[model samples]
Target chain A: MTALLTVDRLSIATQARQLVRNLSFSIAPGERLGLIGESGSGKSLTSLALIGLLPETMAATGSIRLDGTEVIGAGERQLVALRGPAAATIFQEPLTALDPLMRVGRQVGEVVRRRLRHEGLPSSAPAVQTRVLELLSRVALPDPERLARVYPHEMSGGQRQRVAIAMALAWRPKLLVADEPTTALDVTTQAEILALIGQLVREDNMALLFISHDIPVVAGTVDRVAVLRQGELVEAGPVSDVLQAPADPYTRSLVAAARTFDTALGRLF
Target chain B: MNGTAGSMPQTEGKMTRRTIPLSLIVGGVIVGLHLLAGLLTLFWTPYDPTAMVGGRLAGPSLAHWAGTDRLGRDLFTQILIGARIAIEVGSGAVAIGAAIGVTLGILAAFATRTLDDVFAAAFDILIAFPTLLVAMLIVAASQTASLFTAVLAIGIAGSAIIARLTRILAKRVLSMDYIVAARVAGSSWPSIVVVHVLPNIWPTLIVNLALQFGLAAMAESSLSYLGLGAPPPNASWGRLLQEAQGTVYTAPFGAIAPGIALVTLVIGVNLLADGLRAFADPTRRGRR
Candidate 1:
């Protein structure tokens, strides 16, 4: 089995200081990897570098090869080719991730039609609409017909997240990068969204790079876990090993934090 | 104002809210009347707008309507033609401004760091140079201050402001996550601009353009008043106002009629822009 994504000694830096330093990770085809980190851990920066969409002020060094193409220093045309069909990202804030002015259906349809165009298939209105509805339904959204007409502001947080998920899945990318996809939702909605992402990844047989600060959530979603602190990778291992007995002291602290949170919740119950 | 602007639409719903805005209604009526008067000039006026058809400084009557100007030309006829000229100049200048401004702005928004700075500096300098001063320079250069010259000067000068506005608006939209999302979804720059950026920014752009229309019209009248506008027989409202300045005490109607016409048009356009801004803003709409 070949690796779907390979990041080798990747370092991202602004003009003033380094943000992500000497980080390396790889995800094999159909594999799920969770990157667990604290704030300013360079987790988000690494994810952006994977898609070649880092902000202009920051410069990225080292190699990021996704499905055989090098993402670092790639031109916009090449990056555009890789973005949807190869890998797509779902950002933290679903409300801002989707376009507010556009109807949700049209938004999804835009991706579907682009995918069709990329595949050299006819992208007529009816054809696009059918596929759009199929994608909406696949994400377990009820009443795809009516939902497509309403704007993003009309939908709840969870529904909007589902729509974002649908958009990411529209092109059937080989890999999905979800950067704190459920962080903006409430407790109940978070569980639902997390489950949906896991189920969709499994159903599509797609690789996933799930970045989150939540330890238990990462453990539940991914097979392998990589822990990041500041700008460096502190630990990498199976979820069971990391959670049950962390090798690094930093990893141990993270597991202990998760345990404390679990115990607090247990006491509440 | 926010509360009133937001609530009125929700309570009225689709039926009335669509046109229920007080500014839009009042502005629409004033502009509509002006438009009717302008259109009337296409076929008829009381007399030839430039002809000496009545006694000079005569008062309003069935024959002369608003009476006559110093030259004995019908004031009512000149005022009607004035409306037509105002509309022509307003639309023409705005069209030119929007075209030049929007294109440059979008280009500047997409420009690299060095190019963007250059564009920004240029826009600032151009904006600081008064539109009237620029118009004077253009007239000086052309040596013929026709309606075309006025429109060109005003549009060119105003383009800097429009471009600056467009650059700011487009850059803000480009920075949004949805724009990144669109790109990730395989949308090309052109596609993203058409599908996302333009649709997001057009509401604000339109509101500003509406305001620009008023400014351009006023600028045209000022040019005519300064003797740089369309020559005699065109009967621009500014020329009428200028011509009536001396006889203002004698006729009173001469100055009052064109002054009222100019003010009404400007007020109408300004109110329309205000109404549009209130209606189109999402944050304000979200309050409802």
Candidate 2:
């Protein structure tokens, strides 16, 4: 199968320091690839670089191919076209992820509007409204009609994340990059969010690049694993192989930590 | 815990919005009275305000309340017309400032590289200069000296302040995560401005705009006092104040009526704007 996203020797650096160095990986179509790492291990930075959302101060070098388009040096015009259509990202914090001032429904509808404008389809208010509700319900959100009117701060954390997910999937993007999406949620909410993401990824046959610090959370969701230590990829393999027989010392400790959380979380829930 | 924590900021926002402020009432009443004066004078004044309907310099009396001016026009009628002028200049200047300021601020906030640097430099230079002095310069340059020209001058002067404040507020809002998310969602710059930037900046901008109304009134009065505001036959409060100056010792109500009206209107606006600022902040609301 053709790879949906392929990053070759990708390095992100500011004038002062290098954040992600020489990281190489690729996710095939319909494949789920988990990026397991600790905080500041450059997983999030790599994801940001891929989506062209990195801050102006930082620059990305090397190559990032999203759906076969070279995104590393794409101009604003190309990047805008490539972003939502080629790949959509769900960031870690949903509280800040959704626009606080905008209504929840309109936020999702905005992405839908962008899609409609591209297809030469009429984006009437009623059409956008129906699509927004459809997207909301697809994300397993409850009573999207009432939910749409409320602002971001009015919704629960999980609900906000669901709204965010609905927006990310509005264009049916080829690649879905979730950067520690459930990091802010409680254990139960985190599990539900992960399950929802896994289910959507499976159903859409969309390539997934799931970045997380938690190994089991990654293990429970993604089909394959790539372990990052600092800025470098130390190990990369199938989830079962990496979790059962980790090749690197850091990966071994990560597996042990995941098991510990698994049991500890089982009792709490 | 999660849902409550997530909704904390908005809940606080709702609470702040729930309380009807004292300043709004005071300001609303005073400003509302001025608007009432404008409307009342249009259809039914006690006498033709600008006409020589009463004996000149007459004291507060049954026929000529608050006395008459040097021109034999009713002071009370002139005061009512003054309210009309104040409303005209105040709202007009404010409208001009808000429209120009909000547009410039959003442009500066979203501009990149040299454009951003240039706007930043321009804002700094403008902020350092006093708005009244700059407005005088603009009025002198125009040389029209009418109410419309005066309002336009003051509005242009006030735009710099509004633009500076708007740029600062817009920059802060643009840096928020939701803005980043909107970018990721492929929202066009104009759509982002309409959907995200404007709404987020509105509360602070509202208070600032209201406060600008007070400044605009003061500016118009100062211009008129300096022989730079509305022309003759207008009877602006500032001109009334200026005209009453020569006969102050003999006919003090001539000056007192216009002076009191100006102070009352400005105070009303200040109180309202201050209350609005507090109303926008939940922590301040919690303090009360």
**Candidate with maximal TM-score:** 1
Residue-wise lDDT of candidate 2 within B1-288, one digit each (tens)?
A: 243334455444344444767887787788788889888988998888668987889999998878999989899988898888887888899999999988898899988868988998898898788988888898899878888889998898899889988999999988887787777777768878888888778878888887898889888988999999998888789989999999999999999999999888888877777777666643355556
Interface Cα RMSD in Å, per prediction: 7.0, 4.0
lDDT of 1 by residue, B140-199 (tens): 789998999999988887899999999999999998889988887778999988999888
Q: Which parts of model 1 are misplaced by more than 4 Å?
A: B1-20, B277-288
lDDT of 1 at A151: 72
Poorest lDDT segment (10 consecutive residues) of candidate 2 chain A:
A146-155
TM-score for each predicted model, relative to the true structure: 0.95, 0.90
TM-score of chain A of each: 0.99, 0.96
What DockQ do you compute for every candidate structure?
A: 0.45, 0.41
Clashing pairs in 2: none
Pick out the ten consecutive residues of candidate 1 chain B with the lowest summed lDDT: B1-10
